[model samples]
Target: MRFFISVFIILTSIAPAWSDETRLDYSGRTVIYHSDVKLRGSQKRDVRYSHKANFFGAVAINTTKKTNDSNGAAWGYHNLKTAQDNAMRSCRFKADRPEDCVLYLSVVPKGFDFKPKTRTLSNDAVEAYNFLVGWSRLNFDSYRSFAVNGIHTWAYSASAPTREAAEKEALEVCEETFARSQKKKDPAWAKAVYLKEHLQCRIFVTFSPV
Candidate 1:
């Protein structure tokens, strides 16, 4: 039995499809994402433009701003502190629920042009996140929804301002994407986001405390 189990484990590990990459998840919680996208609408523009506008912004804004990438993240945290005193006060789990449950919040964040070839959003010295929680399978509920943003198709970023700029852009995206987040003040970062020439897509994460 031990030999068989060992063989099975080895076979599965050697399978062609396993990767540590966090693709296909809105926030990669290992399971249960409010956002999940299998592929990009366009490879060149580097975005799913329409989705970025409402989903990352509006949804996060609508909920308590427990996490915000723009407008000073600390401000968002302050709002969440206030929600506990107001409307959400009536939620049932506020009293007897187990406090040990862990939760995670992720936003579709970005990487800058000059950020070294291997450095990422989470740098060795700088913690880029606005909020991070120790997560567990027990802590939360989940939902997934995608509206018909518009026609879908392929697009790419515009020709770079210079060859030097283009090369830098590619490298930055490659390195930054390895561990990126979803927060935006504007759409300049993504070269392609949707089926159209002029749009962007973004994704964000949030959590509600009991």
Candidate 2:
């Protein structure tokens, strides 16, 4: 069965909390989150203009310093993935530690809303989903696929040139992983889980360049 998983993966554990947490903008069309580091006059102007001009875009900033002059913004992109990638690329260009760059805000059109596939997943599954989505976004020109057994067990294919190849590989990896875990005699819980939720792997999400 096909499952459409949207963005909005839980990042509580993966990412550190921002000083200024994410919130809906007054206009209700934008979602924004700032950091402890204040933006300079030019940076503020750039952010204001980008949000106003683009229907979909993202902003990233280096949050490790009080004066975060290293920032990036991408607007007028066809998809959020590309916008996010470009923004991060721009921010990392100037960041002392590239890993310090974090996505600050993402703006979508007024009517856009994210709908998740399911909320009953375990915390580890949710984190896995986030990792899959993040990895897919890193390369806008590649096709990627993820598979899940409707529980904590999941796997993803590396970026491939074609959708079919990516999907096939993801399913293979997921099924193989599930099968391997079932034979682990050392972990009693593993065997128990395998018996309780022995679901077959199915394609969960697919990413294609816009």
Candidate 3:
């Protein structure tokens, strides 16, 4: 009896430490997410044109008085140093003092592009969205809705012959669950949510007259 009581006390004491560590769950699988913050955007721009050779691009800014007179790809350079130097020189050419210009940002091997698998919106909602194989001739739409509370989530998905129907079904399922909670006199920590907007969905989808 003493050993069992001691074990219970020990577990209760360490419960707080376990609660601090959060886990990520998707499709019934759970994994630890060490960080809570998510990246929404960055202050960077892609090159308008890229050279076939190993080319470097850079940005230089006039730091004297926070001027918008910046320069990029002023003179094509094979090396980063040369690119940085030229960019600064170009920026200084338009500056009141030539020495006020400094390198602000740089991008190398211009042809390389980076894309994120998921996107977070301004509302602090993280989203994972993709379109299945569909065209005007044959439309099969699928959508998912989720309600989240802190680290917990309830999700529902539906597939239909049209986008509107699929979206409607997903919302109905999610809201039905919410309505049940209200009727049962049980308070819910989460609000019903819809995750339909993709940050870069238009890049992949194109509309044509059928």
Candidate 4:
């Protein structure tokens, strides 16, 4: 009876935490986003590898100051992303089979063109990204209107073929996303403020030392 009781305690102790790790995982996948956010396009995402440090993911906002031939504002938009709600979650990273790897709940800023560059990468990073983008684009295709401080944000499908059309779609999303930062800053942005709209967005959440 005592041996059976000991086994029960051991299993009980291990179960919850293990279940917690399984919190983000369903089947063999890492679940990063909640059941919201809309995604579109080819909708296929590929993961990139990172080297050195253990940085899970980094959120980046693309800045647009390269358009003017004089100022050279050609880079793209500038905006900030939100942090993940984790206290209600089981773990910081996605829960999966490996169990120890960390996943960055990346808050991708709107209009940040995630064009891939030929940089050095790592195997784990490659593995992690492979899992993450699949999840993120799903959120994007089915995104919800996140209302921050009364400013409601929503994402629309990108209208293609023309750069001008892409720009319009990008500005629409960025304007909404920009509202998040603006709300955090007490809702202050003049009509005169320059908005750097992007015609493309490419998020590269790889494991690298940047």
**Clash number for each model:** 21, 0, 0, 23
- The TM-scores of all predictions, comma-separated, are 0.15, 0.40, 0.26, 0.20
lDDT of 4 at 174: 35
* Candidate 4 lDDT tens digits, 135-172: 44554433221111111122322223434443344345
lDDT of each: 0.20, 0.57, 0.30, 0.23
Q: Sort by TM-score, best first: what order?
A: 2, 3, 4, 1
lDDT of 4 at 115: 67
Better of 2 and 4 by TM-score: 2
Could you say which candidate leads in lDDT?
2
* Model 3 alpha-carbon miss at residue 52, Å: 14
List, residue by residue over 141-204, the lDDT tens digit for candidate 2: 8888877764335677757789998899888887776566446323543332222333577887
Q: lDDT (0-100) at residue 80 of candidate 4?
A: 15
Candidate 3 lDDT: 0.30
- Identify the runs in model 3 with alpha carbons over 4 angstroms from their true place: 1-54, 64-76, 110-210
Say which candidate scores most in TM-score. 2
Candidate 4: segments with Cα more than 4 A from true spot: 1-157, 186-210
